[model samples]
Target: MTNTHAAAADGAEPPQGPPAPNHESGTGGAGGKTNPAEGRVPTTHPHPKTHRTPDGLDAHLVVNRTTFRLDIKLTAAPGDVVALLGPNGAGKTTALRALAGLVPLTAGHLRLDGAELDRTPPESRPVGVVFQDYLLFPHLTALDNIAFGPRCQGATKAASRAQAAEWLARMGLTEHATAKPRHLSGGQSQRVALARALATSPRLLLLDEPLAALDARTRLEVRAQLRRHLAEFEAVAVLVTHDPLDAMVLADRLVVIEDGRAVQEGTPSDIARHPRTDYIAQLVGLNLYKGHADGHTVRLDIGPAITTTEILSGPAFVAFPPSAVTLFRDPPTGSSARNHWRCEVAGLETHGDQIRADLTGELPLAADLTTVAAAELDLHPGAPVWATVKATQTHAYPA
Candidate 1:
C-alpha cells in the first residue's frame, strides 16, 4: 500500500493505500464510446410489483485503461444495499472507485438523488467510502477519526466531535472513543471507519471488502452488526467484495461481475438457485451445465445428457448440488436415479464435514459424500466409479 492511498483522510479522496491497477490512469476521451449491450439489461432488479424511486442512485460506470475496461451499470433505491460480487481482478474495486470519484469515468454517467455527479470531484461528491483496511488515522483517537469527515465538511469543531460522540454511542463504541487506532481491535477499527464514513451523512455509501480484514471469529460478529447497520441505512449502499457469503448476507441484490462486466444481477436467493455463469455456480457451490433441453433431458455442451424433472425445450441450464450426487464403486443396474455416468475419480478434498470427489470420464462432476462412505468405497484418484443424481434433484432453467 502506498502512503498516499493509506492516509486515513476523510472522503476528500479514497483512503490511502497501495494504488490499484485500474486507478493508475483516469479516463480520457471515453465519452465518445458507447456500449451496445448496455441497454440489453435492465438497470435494476426490483421485486415483483415494486417500483424503484427515481431519487436514488443511477450510475453506468465505464473506465478504459490500457489493460482493463470496466463497463457496468448500477442502480439502487434508497435503503437498498447492492453488492458488486466477483473474483479478484474483476473490476469490483474499480467500479467502487469510479462511484467514489476516485477514478474518473471514461464514458457513462453517475447520478444520485436526482443530481448528476459524473464530473464531481471526490471531495465534492455526496459519497462516503469505507476502505477494505478500515484506514483509521494512526495518530487520532476514535472520536477524532470519526469527527474528521464532518470537520472537513465545515462543521464546527465541537459540533463535529459531538456528532462523532453520538455515532460512537450508536456503534457501541462509546468506551473506545478516546483510544487510538493502534489500540483498537479489528472490529472496533471497522466500526470507527464506518462511523467516520457516516459522520458526514453521505447519500451514497461505498464499502470495499468491509469484512476482509477480520479473522473468522470476529467476522461472524461484525458481519451481523454490519448487516444490521446496512439495514438501518436510509440511503443507497454499494459493497465491493469477492466473498460470496459477504455479498449474499449484506446486499439486497447481487451484481456478479467478471472480466470487468456484469454477468448477472439478481436477488441473493435467485442468483443462488439459478446461477447464469460457471463462476457464480462455483461460488454458490453448484454443479452447473448449459445445454439443449428436450422433453425431460438436457444434453450438456461438455458432458453427457442429464435427465431432470423440468420439461423444457431449446437452450437451458441444469444445476444440481454436489451433495445430490451419489457415487458407487460400480454401476448398479437397479438404481432408481435417472441420471448416471461412468466416471473416474480425479481428485479428492475435504469439504466441510464431507469428502468432495472431483471426477472425470463419461461426465465430469463433483460428488460430496461422508468420510465413512468414501472409506467404504476406497475412493482415490484414478478409481472407476459410477455417479448418479436423481432426476428430482436437478433443477433446469432457461439460459
Candidate 2:
C-alpha cells in the first residue's frame, strides 16, 4: 500500500481576508496584455474552503524516469512553511519541480485550495518559483525583473510597475530597482528574485535552495529577512534545501526525503530529538546505533553492548552526542561509566570551542574535549585511548 500522511503545522490557518492588495492580481492575461478596466488577472485564488479538499495543499506526486523514480506525498495549511530536506540527488528538487508543473507527474494528484492542478500548465498554475541560481534576467533591471510577472498576468505597464515598487520596498531593494542583475550583489539579487515571485501573490509558493547562492555572512542576513516575509505570507510555502540549519530555521515542518521517497516528516525539533535514520542522525550531529534489545541492555548490530536507562525490548536505536563521551589515556580501574571501548585516535579537529577526537576501535565514536585537556593528554592521531559513557547519557528508543 502507498504511504499517505497529513502533516499539519502548529498554527497553520485557512485562507484569510481578501488576500493582500499587493498580491491580489494572481492570474494574468492571454498574450501578455492587460485587460483594461477589469484590472484583475484571469487566474483563480478561490477561498480555501470553496474547494472542499483540505484548507491548504494536498498532493501525491510521482515522477518516473529511466534511471529513477520519485513518489512523495505532501500536505500543508495556508500559513505553513514546509521545507523539503535531503542530501544531494535525494529527489528534493524533483519534488519541487513536479509541484511547479515544470516536470510532469506520471501518476498521483495535485491540488491547491481545492483546485486540481495535475493538468494545468506552468503559467496557469497559481504558483511562483525561486530557483537556486536566482535565474534573474541579466538584461533586465531589478524593477523590470519583478514587473515581468505582473505584466504577464495582464496588468498594464503602469499598474505592474506600481505593484513591483511595493514588493521592492518590502524587500528593501527600492534603491537598487534601476540596477541590472549583474550590478546587484548576491543578496540583493536574491531579494529581487524573491520579490518577483511574490509579486504575483501566488496561493502556493515554491523556493529551490533560496539561500544557496549567497555567501556565509550574506546568507545569515537574507535568511532572517526571508523568514519575516514568510511569516506574513498567508499562503502555503515550500522550500527545497540541503542545509539542515536552513530547514530548521525557516520552516514550520521538515520533510526528509531519501532515495526518492520521504523517509521522515515532522516538526524540526521532533525530528532532531528522535531521528529515525542514520542520515538524519548524522545530519543532526548525533551518534546513532541500531541494536537488539533485552530490557535495558542493547547489543549493537556492529558487535557492542550498550546499557540504557530505558527498558526497551526487541529492535531498538541508541543515540548520544559526541560531548557525552569521555576519553582517557588508559583504561580506568574503577569507573562509574557502564560502557567502555578501547580505541585508537584516528583524527582530531576543532569543533567550535571544543576539540573533537575521532576514534576507531571496538566501537567507532567521536569524543569531545577541551583544547587544554587535549594538550595535557598530548593527544594526537594514532594514540591509543579508552572511551567511556555512563548509561544515563545514552537515549534508547524502539526502532
Candidate 3:
C-alpha cells in the first residue's frame, strides 16, 4: 500500500496540553501552548475573532470539486474529540482532507490556536493522521513504525527509537516492539498506528475511520482503547466515521454532514433525541418528521398528524424509535394509542434479534417486531398493517 503519514517540522515541541487558550494574547496563554505557529501567513480575511480559540481549532473549510462542493465550519476546544458523521458521498472525508491540508480550500480559513494555517504545507503543519488502514511501513518493525514521525522531524536515530519505545510501552505493546505490521494482531496494529500518530505530538489529530479496519471482536476491544487514548489526548482531534456507535462513544460532540453541508450538530444524546434531518434520524435509528405544531399536535407536511407530549406552537419535529411502534394486522378501535397509520410493508430485514419492517403509507416509518410476532402476522413485503404509537412514546422539539 501507499505511505500517507506526514511529520511536523524540525525543532517543533510536543504539545503540553491545554488549560484553555487565552483570547487576549492570541496564543495559549495561561493554558500551556500546544503548537505555536512558526510564522503567520498573511490573509485578507482573518478568521472571525468570535470563533478564535488560541488553544484549539477553528476552521471554516470549503473545498470545491468539479462535481461536488464541501462547506463546513468545525470548531473544537483543546482536548475535544469531534466526529464528522454521514453516509457515503456525504463529504466527511473531504472535510478531513481539508483539515489535513491534503486538499486546498476554495474559500474560508483554517486556523489552529489562533494562527492561520490556510496555506501551510501538509508536512509543515503541526498535525498528525491515523488512516483507516494504519499504513504502517510493511518492512518496518512496530518500534520503527512508531518512531518514523519523530525521526522525520529531525530526532536522532537513538532518541527517536527511545521515544517510540516510550509510546509502545504506554500503548501496552512493548512486547510487540520488534514485531512487524504483518505480525501484529488487528488491535495491536491499531494501537501501533495511534502511537505513531501521537508520537509526533501533533496539535491537531485527524482520524479517518480509525476503527473501520478491525474485525467485530477486535473493534470492540480496540474501540475502548482508542476512546481512552483520545480522552487522554490534549490536542484537538477530528474523527471521520459513518458508524453511529463510534461517533457516539468516541466524540465529545458530533457534526452530522449530508450533501456537503452540516445538517445538525450536538451532543450524542441531544442529536439522538432530536434529529433535525432524516439522515440523522436514520443514523440514530429514530423515525423523524417535520411539521407545524399547535399545542400537543403536529401536522406533518405530508403525513398524518402526530400527538406528542410536548406542548408547543410553531415549526417542530417529532421522533420515535422503531421499538415504540406496535404493528397490528387490523386497525383496532378503542386503543390507547393516540396515533395510528395504515401502512404497507415496504421491506423486512433482521436487525439484531428483531425483524425491522420498513413501512410506507400515511407515514413512512420503521417498526421492530419479534420473530414470533412477525410469524404470527405473516409479515412480508406488500402486506398491509396498522402501526400505532402512544403519544408518550413520541418526543417533540423545536425545529
Tell me, by TM-score, which candidate is best: 1
Q: What would the per-residue lDDT of candidate 3 be over residues 1-399, giving only the tens digit for each residue?
A: 001222223332222232111111112223212111111111111111223245699999999999999999999997789999999999998898788776889999999988899997565667776777766767778887766655555555677688788778878999999998899998898888787667666678888898998899999999999898787777788899999999999999999999999998999988988899988888889999999999999999998899999999999999999999999989878899999999999999999999999999999999999999999999999999999999999999999
For model 2, give the 10-residue run with minimal summed lDDT. 1-10
Provide the TM-score for each candidate, comma-separated. Answer: 0.87, 0.85, 0.86
Question: What would the per-residue lDDT of candidate 2 be over residues 349-397, giving only the tens digit for each residue?
Answer: 9999999999999999888999999998889999999999999999998
For each candidate, what is the lDDT?
A: 0.78, 0.78, 0.78
lDDT against true structure, model 1:
0.78
Model 1 reaches what TM-score against the true structure?
Answer: 0.87
- What candidate 3 gets wrong by more than 4 Å, as runs, is 1-53
In terms of lDDT, model 2 sits at: 0.78
Query: What are the per-residue Cα lDDT tens digits for candidate 1 across 114-168?
Result: 8999987555566777776775767678887766655554555677678778778
Better of 1 and 3 by TM-score: 1
Report the number of clashing residue pairs per model.
8, 4, 0
Global Cα RMSD, each model: 8.2, 9.6, 9.1
Residue pairs in clash, model 1: 1-18, 2-17, 2-18, 5-16, 5-17, 6-16, 6-17, 7-16
